[model samples]
Target: MGGSGLLGLEVTRQARRAGQRVATTFHTRRPDGDAHHLDIRDRAAVIALVRAVEPAVVVNAAYLQADWATTADGGTHVALAAAATGARLVHVSSDAVFSGAAGRYDETAVPDPITPYGAAKAAAETAVKAITPAAVIARTSLIIGRGDSQHERQVHALAGGAPGALFTDDLRCPVDVGDLAAALLELASSPHAGVHHVAGAGAVSRHELGVLIARRDGLDESALPRALRAGSGLPGPADVRLDNTKTQALLTTRLRGAREFLASPLPVE
Candidate 1:
């Protein structure tokens, strides 16, 4: 539904490139081309939109990090609407659902959220599963894009003398946005049901990721400060890696690790 966001935009683009008639949605920011303005918080509106679109497959990539109604309850609303319309659903979830207590999480690992955002995502997963047993709840980690993602932007800002250091202790398996979107589309058309871990093959700390981004963007890596997330009082997990072994086997889309994807600089436009 979030056709304006990073992953959503790529999904829409790839789907259309493959000859799929796509109908996108946005919340606050309006996206280019044909897209519906949807407030998923309103159950009635969500249902009406889904019914009007009559899509064969529904992929919800919308979520507000701080809003419970949008992340948790809104996911349920989409599931309910998708179920009512008999459309296949793929709900995007996050590794935030894990507390990093297990260090690594597989598709079968139960969620143990340590932050509010994580809890909300966990709750959404539970609701989506109950409402649509056949729906795919795809949990992912940091989504890295080509110089446009938040993490990449942050690295650039730090290189330009912005304050704050990237955490060396906070580890994640950052996936390429294109790979993730492709994987999601593949899952949408596949027989896979329930939770799936779609993430990168290699795990790297936040600081290391920042360094890779800096090098790729032609910035000075030394300018990017480094710190430990452990005593930084950050209210999130320290190391939560998604095990994409099972899901990777089911799809042809390769989820490239941050090191591999960011290994090269962006091509000149």
Candidate 2:
């Protein structure tokens, strides 16, 4: 639903390019062009919007890391609305659902969240599954954009003498935003149901990812500071990698790794 965010914006752009009649939802900041202002926290509003749109498929990309009502309860509200309208649902999820205890997770791995955000995401996944059994609960890891993603921005800021250091021990499989959006769209139109792991091909530490980003953007990679997340008392997972081998087999779209995608500079706008 979040048509203004990076991944959501890419999804909307790709869908429009494919000649699909898309209706997007926004929360605080409205997206450019036409969009429905939807506060998914309100169940009745969610239902009303879904009914009004009468969409053939619904891709809910809206979420808040800190708000339980929005991430968990809001997801349920969306699911209930989508189920009632019989719309094919592709609910975007996060790898934060995992505790990183298992190191790697497939579609079958049960969520063991240690943080509030992770717990909320897990709860959302559970509710979406129970409400809409046919819905695709696509769980993903760190989403990396060419130059506009938060990670990229942080790297830029750090290189420019920002205080924070990218964690060297905090590992993730960062997927390209374009590839992830394409995969989500593919699953929306496909017959796949249940949980799916849609992530990049390889795993890299957050620091390494930042270095790649630095190089891609012509920054001094050494200028980016690094630290271990283990002793830093970060309340999140350390090495959660989504096993996308199974999901990759089912889709034609190739999910490129960060090393591959960030190897060369993107064309300047």
Candidate 3:
């Protein structure tokens, strides 16, 4: 694994449980595992790391690098390294690759990103696919876990008397970090090696999700009123729901619904 982001960290943990020798990198806040200081953009460093580990499979959970070229080119580097070492690659991607203009996106959805972050991810996806179609490209949506995330912070602040507005227009299928990690790991071992969408089983608007969180935490729904409804004019995706039929059918672990994911009290590693 590369980078200790929420999903990356979860993937690392699951890999350990699967009895796979796990090696990860961290910019800061290293996890309780074998970690090293790595900058993915450094092709030589990535190549060296893979070569040193001599891993049978390489999973690039790290995306959204400091630079666009870093992510785009770094993906190419990782893919090439995997090919060079004959290691199967499992690359994590994002649902932001699709334009908001479309409805629910599935495995066959054509990527049409609208944001720089999304564009970088899309570019990296292309690079990975080009290098090896056998590589598993797992795309997901807003992952919720580890209250340290911006989304969780927003929920916390709203519950703690911080009045804010959440867009009602933005709809997504937010998956739990752990669930996504498990699915990706299963994909790594499965024969299906292509782009797959691993996200929450159900789709909910941002406002609805806020309401669910507020209710779960026993917060007054009136406190985050604007966040619970679509009113005025908010520019955001109406719906970016991901169809996980393929992911559910092929992976060993099934994704949890956003409500189930939030309601279940899982320890954040």
Q: Write the per-residue lDDT of candidate 3 for residues 133-212, one digit (tens) a residue.
A: 89999998988875655677687687678777766767899988778888887888878888999898998877777777
lDDT of 1 by residue, 1-269 (tens): 98999999999999999999999999888887779999989999999999999999999999999999999989999999999999999999999999999998899899999999999999999999999999999999999887799998899999999999999888899999999999999999999999999999989999999999988878999989999888787798999999999999899999888889989878676
Candidate 3 local lDDT, residue 128: 90
Which residue ranges in model 1 land beyond 4 Å of their true spot? none
Model 3 stretches with alpha carbons more than 4 Å out: 225-236, 266-269
- Any idea what lDDT model 3 has? 0.79
Q: Using lDDT as the measure, name the better of candidate 2 and candidate 3.
A: 2
- TM match of model 2 to true structure: 0.98
Cα lDDT for residue 87, candidate 3? 92
Tens digits of per-residue lDDT, candidate 2, 1-269, equal 88888988999999999999888999888887669998989999999999998999999999999899999999999999999999999999999999999998999999999999999999999999999999999999999887889999999999999999999888899999999999999999999999999999999999999999988888999999989998887698898999999999999999999999899779777
* Model 2 clash number: 1
Location of the lowest summed lDDT over 10 successive residues in candidate 3? 227-236
